[model samples]
Target: MKSLRLYGKQDLRYEEADNPVIENTDDVIVKVKAVGICGSDISRYKKLGPYVEGMVFGHEFAGEVTEVGSGVEGIRPGDRVAACPTFYCGECESCKKGELSRCEKLTVIGARHPGAYAEYVKLPAENILPLPDNVDYDTAAMVEPSSVVAHGFYRTSIKPGAEVAIMGCGSIGLLAVQWAKIFGAKKVYAIDIDDAKLEVAKEVGADVLINSMEKPAHEQIMDHTNGSGVDLAVESAGSPITSAQVFALPKKGGEVVFMGIPYADINIERFYFEKIVRSELTVLGSWNAISSPFPGKEWTSSVHYMSTGQINVKPMISHRLQLSEGPETFDNLINRKGSYVKVLFYPELD
Candidate 1:
């Protein structure tokens, strides 16, 4: 199998690896189809995270089932599926309470376990989700990421006619823009320094676009909302600056949710910090896409919406390359040499 392996910081290699086989009674093997690069993948590649040396290097993917263990019923070969790569320790306190995402030993494939960036990958039957005929492999490859955004939205108390401000226009932010609409936001604002990304956000249903580079994002959001701010604000840039600035985008008593992982120390300014204290904001930090019954409704809803043409990822896909391009692609992505929103790699591509 041809796969990409992370050797160390900024070191990703495209090479041949052994094929994955069913190792447990409930195990299943999927032929690699479409795999997408994630922001966290970039971050982890730049700075090593919890991973096995030279492990297969991706998680967000969809593929055809090639084989299934005897115990794997209901799913069989030739099935098209999107997989939940998340793993939770079933006995952890959080899992015991039906909060699978919060399991003390929560981790995911492409980390300690081998991942989907290969000719074949294996997983337990429960992690496999069958895709409807309406959802193509490219779109199904995005289910994991879409579910991530849905999980964050599900944590909010957004009501119909509420206003929403998404403080980023990256893939996650673009998804947040659409999820805001799904959650019934009367108006949704997309904020970012890049006009290109903001345009994509507009294409995906954001009602307003704010180039935070022109002015502080919060200020522009306030101007649009009659200086009252929005009912809910989402920080999805994973940027140290936006992590703090997001506090000021919501009105007093409004909600703020942090979905992006700002990998550095965040120093909140007095102005932004005071919004949380003075406004009595309800702030939350949402993690990976799992919940109670394992992969949970986030995955189901994401697949459902994608099947219905609601959660569109077409605009978010900026590049589609073969697995062999992994090394150079990672460099170009971090070096800012090209327009990158979401980059998907097809393992079977020639």
Candidate 2:
């Protein structure tokens, strides 16, 4: 099988590898159909990795089941599925409380375990979410990322008529714009450095678009909110600058959700730190979505939205590359030389 394996920091190779087989009784071997490149994947490629050398690394993927282990039930061979990347020990207290993301024993695919950056990948059947026939592989692969946005919204306390400012226009940020509308946000501000991404944000549902590079994102958001800042501020850009902006873009006593993972030390100035203390703002940090009641409500909701055409992912996908183009594709995304969003990699050539 052909796979993209991590060699080291700034090194990813498209090479040959042995096909994965079912190792555990509940394991399922999937012939990977499509996989989406995530921001974390980019970080790993750039040497910001705890990634293992020679390990396959893609968590957002969908495929057809080719083999199923004996202990697995309900799911059979040939089932179209999108599997959750985060797996938890069902016996943990957190898992018992339906907080699968907080399970004491958590193993994430593409990080702690083998991932889907190949022709085939193996995972426990419990992680699989059976996809409807109407959902294509490209969209199915998107379920993982879309679920992240869904989970972010679930953690916030935004009311139906609340105003929202999503501080980024990346894939997750753009998705957050739509989720804000779906959740009945009356006004949404999509903030980014790129106008192209802001345009997409508007097409999705942003009532206001601000290029943070051209002017102050917080100033624009505050202006729209009549000097009171947005009711809800979601930080999805994961940069120090954006993180600082989100802290100052929420109304006093408003809610702020930190959905982005910062790669560097984020220094909050004394003014902003004092503001957080004085304003009584609720700050939340949301990690990967969980599998509550099995397979996660976020994943299920994303599937429902996608299947019903309520949340369309067609426009977000800007590039599709063959598996062999892994090296160049990573470079293109890293350099930001192309108009790209949600790049998908197809392992099998039709």
Candidate 3:
């Protein structure tokens, strides 16, 4: 087997390694078919440090089960599946309460464990969700990312016919727009500096697209909303600038969902005094989805959404390269030098 290991910052090597064996009673071995690179991967790729050394750098993946342990049931050797990136012990207090993402021993693939950017990946069978026969490997690899957007929407309680604005036109933001539309939002606005991303947002059904570079996003959103501000604002850009802009676009007593992972401290005084005091706004911070929670039954619903062509991921995949080109893909993404939305690496190829 072969694995793409991170030796240090900006250094990724394709190292030959032994195939992973089932080490736990509930573990399963998957022959990875497709894996997508995420934005967080770029942050780790460009930083200089041991923070992510020895890490196998991929989390979103789809594959076939080659082996299953004694405790595994309901899943067979030949079943195609999408592996959830987050791992939980299933016995923790949080897990017992259906909060799997916050389980005491939670470990995320590609972060705390050997990830999917390799020929084989080892994960608990409980973490694998069956992929529909109609879904392709590339789209199946998108389950994790799409699920994140689904989970975020679940947190905010976004209502049909409500005004919504999503900051950032990355894959997640684009997915959020689609989810908003599917959920019956009356008006959806996508904000981004990149015209290309905004174009994708429009194609995917965003009611309005705002290029922040051309005009102030807050003003444009207010104008569209009749100066009342959007009912719900989702921040997915993961930057202080865009994160701060969310407060300005949401109406007093509106809901703000922070879905992006900010790398640095964000100042929220205006959000505290102005938005919070004047309008009694609700600010919700959403992280990874709990596979066993409220929408537990909807896990399959998400797969169905993708399989039935309700949420198309075909337009999101921008680059597909061999494992040898992994480093270059990381560089291009970090530098924003290429026109890409999502990049996948095929480790099985030479």
lDDT of 2 by residue, 214-332 (tens): 87887777777788888889999988877886878888998899888878888888767775888789998887888577667899998888788767777888888898988888887
lDDT string, candidate 3, 57-102, tens digits: 6888999999999999988899999877786787989889887767
- lDDT of each prediction vs. the true structure? 0.92, 0.85, 0.82
What does the lDDT come to for candidate 2?
Answer: 0.85
Task: Candidate 1: list runs displaced more than 4 Å.
Answer: none
Error of 1 at 281 (Å): 0.4
Two-way lDDT contest, 2 vs 3, winner: 2
Give the lowest summed-lDDT range of ten residues in model 1.
Answer: 46-55
Best by lDDT: 1
Worst 10 residues of 2 by lDDT: 46-55
In angstroms, give how far residue 74 of model 1 lies from its true place. 0.5
State candidate 3's TM-score. 0.93
- Shift of residue 62 alpha carbon in model 3, Å: 0.4
The runs of at least 3 residues in candidate 3 whose Cα sits more than 4 Å from the true structure, single-residue gaps closed, are: 48-52, 90-93, 268-273, 291-298
